[model samples]
Target: MSKASRYEWRDQQASLQERMKGFMENPGTEQLQAVLTEMHAYAAAAQDGSIDIPERFIAFS
Candidate 1:
C-alpha cells in the first residue's frame, strides 16, 4: 500500500488498541453478558438451520 494508506491504517489500529486496553481495564460485565447471550442465540440459529454459517467455518469460540 501507499505510504499515506499505511499511516492511516496504523492510526486506526493504534486507536482500536487504546480503546480495547481501556475496556480491558474496566469491563462492563452486564454488556458483555448481553453480547454473549446474543451470540449464543445466533449460534443456535445456525445450528438449527434457521440461519447458515459460512461453509468451512470452524467451531465458535
Candidate 2:
C-alpha cells in the first residue's frame, strides 16, 4: 500500500481499538465478543477495499 493508505489504515485500526475499549468497559463478555467479531469483519472488508465508510459511520454513530 501507499504510505498514505497505510496511515489511514492505522487510523482506522486505532478507531476500532477505541470502539472496542468503550464496548469492553460497559458491556458483558458476549456483547464485547460480538463487537470484536463485527470489527474483524469490518477490518477484512477494509483490507479488501469493500468497506462502506459512510454507511458504517451512520451505523456506528
Candidate 3:
C-alpha cells in the first residue's frame, strides 16, 4: 500500500485491536445463541413461545 494509506490504516489498527480486546473479554448475550433456527436455543422457543432451557443452563451461560 502507499505510505499515506498505510498511515491511515495504522491509526485504525489500534481502534480495531481495542474493539477485539473488548469482545474477547466478554462475548455477552450473542454468544448464547449462534443462529436463528429451531435447532438453536432461543429460536426453538420463539416458534411456539415455549421456554426450553433449564435454570442451571441459564446461570452457566
Candidate 4:
C-alpha cells in the first residue's frame, strides 16, 4: 500500500480502538440491557457449559 493509504488505515484502526474503549468504559442503556438479557438467557440455558461475561454489568432483579 501507498504511504497515504497506510496512514489512513492506521487512523481508522485508531479511531475504532478509541471508540471501543469508550464503549467498554461506559456503554449506553440499550447496550447494557442487551448484555444483561444475554447473560440471563445464558444462565437459564447453558447448553455449552461456558459463557464469556463482560468486565462490567448490572443485573436488576
Q: Considering every candidate listed, which one attains the maximal lDDT?
A: 2
lDDT of each: 0.54, 0.67, 0.43, 0.53
lDDT of 1 by residue, 1-61 (tens): 4556455544544454555565567789754565556556655755775543333424354
Give the alpha carbon lDDT tens digit for every residue of 12-59 in model 4: 444545655655888997656655654465555335434333345454
- Count backbone clashes in candidate 2: 0
Clashing pairs in 4: none
Looking at model 4, how many pairs of residues clash? 0
RMSD, each candidate, Å?
11.3, 9.3, 18.3, 14.5
Point out the higher-scoring one by lDDT: 2 or 4.
Answer: 2
Q: Tens digit of lDDT per residue, candidate 2, span 32-58?
A: 876788698777977789543433222
> Between the candidate structures 3 and 4, which one is better when assessed by TM-score?
4
Alpha carbon deviation, residue 1, candidate 3 (Å): 3.5
lDDT of 2: 0.67
> Lowest lDDT 10-mer window, candidate 4?
45-54
Query: What does candidate 1 score in Cα RMSD to the true structure?
Result: 11.3
Candidate 3 residue lDDT tens string, 1-61: 4556444444544444555555567776553232222134334443554433222322232
